[model samples]
Each structure stands twice: as structure tokens, then as C-alpha cells.
Target: MSDQIILTTSSHLEGYRVTEHLDIVSAECVFGMNVFKDMFAGIRDIFGGRNKSSQNALRDARTSCLEELRKEAREKGANAVIGVDLDYSEISGGGKSMLFLVATGTAVKVEKV
Candidate 1:
């Protein structure tokens, strides 16, 4: 394996064969929504503009989660991650809401097929 870890959404990489199946690794990121973003949610359509606030939040969370996932896999002696999954959830209460991102995968050791 190289210095960088290989990550794939599929169960296996085409050119590589699994030699050891490590433990399942996961990472989470929580993104908070400001009042302004929520209040202007409906007005965005009137101005015919994209929801930059939401987009930024999603992008940031996704990046954080994936990076953390890679770190977790690497720590467990895994050269690659297979069967990756990303899940998003909304947690709201008391008129406030936050976006939660979770990334999970099976850490594995792989070699050339």
C-alpha cells in the first residue's frame, strides 16, 4: 500500500483484493444553522439564487467527516476503506436546528489482485 489510503463506495476495489478485514470505522460532523440562514430560507427562491448557507454547511460537514474517516482507518492499520457510506440527519429542538453528518466504512488491508 502507498502513503495514501484508497477509499471506495463499492464493497471491493476492482484491481485490489482484500487480505484482511479490519474493524468498522466511523466519523461524525455536526453543523449548526444560524438564525439568518433559517429566516431567509424561503426568500432565496424569490431572489432566484442558490442557498449558499446550506450548501456551505453541507460541504464543510462532508469534508470534515471524510477526512476523519480516513484518519480512523489509517490508525487501525488499514490501507483502504471499502463499502463507504455517508448519512445526514437533522437535529432540531427549541427553534434551533443542526445538520449531522456521519461517515462509515469497513477498514481493510488490500493487495494487488
Candidate 2:
């Protein structure tokens, strides 16, 4: 633990949580399943209609990725994860889609004698 950390004095949360803005100190990873979703999207595009299946799959992927990030944060001894950001994209030339979830915040350890 560093002296600059405010929460270091108290034996409470390891770090502060800011839902509106997640701090940037660590890495951001992604997890998603879009192989089948993309295929449906392409089919819907040809018919000029909405691709509900693809959209739902993307949403599911985003949720799953976020959960994974939360678990990682917990393992890293983080009290809470803030400033979470999510994104979805379709890879070019590959019939695959990607769901990215970014969770960022400070990881701190309590100072003890």
C-alpha cells in the first residue's frame, strides 16, 4: 500500500468505487460468441429486416464478459470495479463477432504493521 491512497488509513474497502467513471490502471479483456449470431445478422441484412437473434446474442456476450471481468477483479483483491465500459464488433473477413468488456479501477492493499 502507498501513502497517497486515502482508504489506506481505514481497514475497510481496498479501493474506492466510481461507477460513473472506471479508473484506468490495468488491462481490459473481452469475451464473446458471435459465430452463429453473425450468420443470422447476414441473413437478416439480405432480407432487409432487423436481426433480433444477433442482437440478443451480442447482449448475452456482453453480460458474460462483464461477469468474467468482475471475477478477475475479485481475484486481484479489488474491493469493487468501476468505470466499466463495453463494446461489440464484427470481425472483417471472418464470420465471427467480438464482445469486449472493460473494467478498470485501482487495486489496493491495506497497510498493516
Model 1, C-alpha of 19: deviation from truth (Å) = 0.7
TM-scores, all candidates, are 0.83, 0.47
lDDT of each: 0.86, 0.47
1-113 in candidate 1: lDDT tens per residue?
Answer: 57788989999999999999999999998877664367466675444466665566577788889999999999999999999999999888998888788999999999997
lDDT of 2 by residue, 1-113 (tens): 33232222222443443332223333355544545555665674544465666666657665566566555655665544444445444444375555554444444433332
Candidate 2: RMSD over Cα atoms?
9.4
What local lDDT score does residue 13 receive in model 2, on the 0 to 100 scale? 43
Top TM-score prediction, candidate number = 1
Q: Give the range where candidate 1 is weakest over 10 consecutive residues by summed lDDT.
A: 39-48
Q: Count the backbone clashes (under 3 Å) in each candidate.
A: 0, 2
- The total of clashing pairs for model 1 equals 0
